[model samples]
Target: MPAGEVRLVFCNAPDRDCAERIARALVEQGLAACANLLPDCLSIYAWQGQVEHAHETPMLIKTTAVRLPEVIGLIQALHPYEVPEIIALPVTEGLPAYLQWVRGQTLPLDKSA
Candidate 1:
C-alpha cells in the first residue's frame, strides 16, 4: 500500500476496436504491462449540458508508478475522445509475484530484471 507501488489506469472507449487499439499500444510501448478490456459497460453521465447514456468498453491498464505519467500522456495523445477518462487508482493489495511481473513488463528492456 505504498503511495505508488502499482496503478490501475481506468479508461473507457466508445467501442471494442478503440479500446483494443489503446490497450495494444500501451502494452507494446511498455507503458502498461497489460490491459483488460471489459465490454458492454453502460455509462450514464452529463456531457456538455445534457444527460447521456452510452455503451462503452472499459480498459484496466496495469502499470507501475514510475510509468504512470508516460502512460497517461500516451493515452491522451491516442484516445479518440476529446476528454478521455484516464483515472489512476493505486493497487492496495495484490499477489507479490503478479505485481513484480507488472513492474518488469512496464520497465524498459535495459532496466528490467
Candidate 2:
C-alpha cells in the first residue's frame, strides 16, 4: 500500500564534516526531522566528461513535501561541486507514529522564501 505518509531524500557529501554541516543546516532550517550519515562509501561516476571516483558519505534525510524545495536550494548553495545529486522518494509505507513525528518536526515552509 502506498502510505504517502512521509518523504525520503537521498543526499551525499564528500566526507563526514560536509555531511554534518548539511544535516545541521537542514535541521536548523526546519527542513528535516532526522538525518542518517553513512560514511566510507566508494562512488564512481562520470563528471565533466571524465570518469571520477571518490569516497563519500551518504545521508538519508527524513522530511515532508512542504519543505522539499528549501532543502534542494540549501544543498545547491552549500555543496562544493558544480552538480550534486539530490533525489526524493515518497514514503509508501511507514509506521504512522514515526511519520507523524516527521511532520511535527518540520515547520510550514514560507511561500515567500
Candidate 3:
C-alpha cells in the first residue's frame, strides 16, 4: 500500500464499554487494523438548535483507505448516537513497516495471506 492509502479515523462513543465494543468488532472483522480507546473526552456541541455537553470515549482507528467505507458503515450500524462522530484523515507519513502492517491487518481474510 502507498503512503496516502492509510487513514486515521476518529470516532467517539458514548462510554468506555461502547468504545471497547466498537473497537473489538472493527479489529475482529478486519475493518480496522487497530483502535485506540482514549481517555474520557468532554464534547460540547450544538444539536437541534441547542447546546449539549457530554463525556465521550474517543477512538483512534487505523486502517487503509480501501476499508474506510466498511469501517464507517459498521460504526454507524453499531453506534448509539443518531449522528456519531466519524472522521478519517489521510496518513501522509509514518513508519514504513507500521504503515505496511496496518494495510496488511485491514485486508480481507482471503487477501491477507
* TM per candidate: 0.90, 0.89, 0.93
Cα error, residue 9 of model 1, in Å, equals: 0.8
Find the candidate with the highest TM-score and give its number: 3
Q: Number of backbone collisions per candidate, in order? A: 0, 1, 0
Against the reference, the lDDT scores of all candidates come to 0.88, 0.86, 0.92
TM-score of 1: 0.90
Mind giving the per-residue lDDT tens digits that candidate 3 earns over 50-71?
A: 9999999999999988889899
Question: Model 1: which residue pairs collide?
Answer: none
For model 2, the superposed segments whose C-alpha errors exceed 4 Å read 1-5, 109-113
Which candidate number has the best lDDT? 3
User: Given candidate 3, what's the lDDT at residue 74?
Assistant: 95
lDDT tens digits, residues 1-113, model 2? 22234789998898889989999999988888999998569999998899999999999999888778888999888888678889999887878899989988886755899
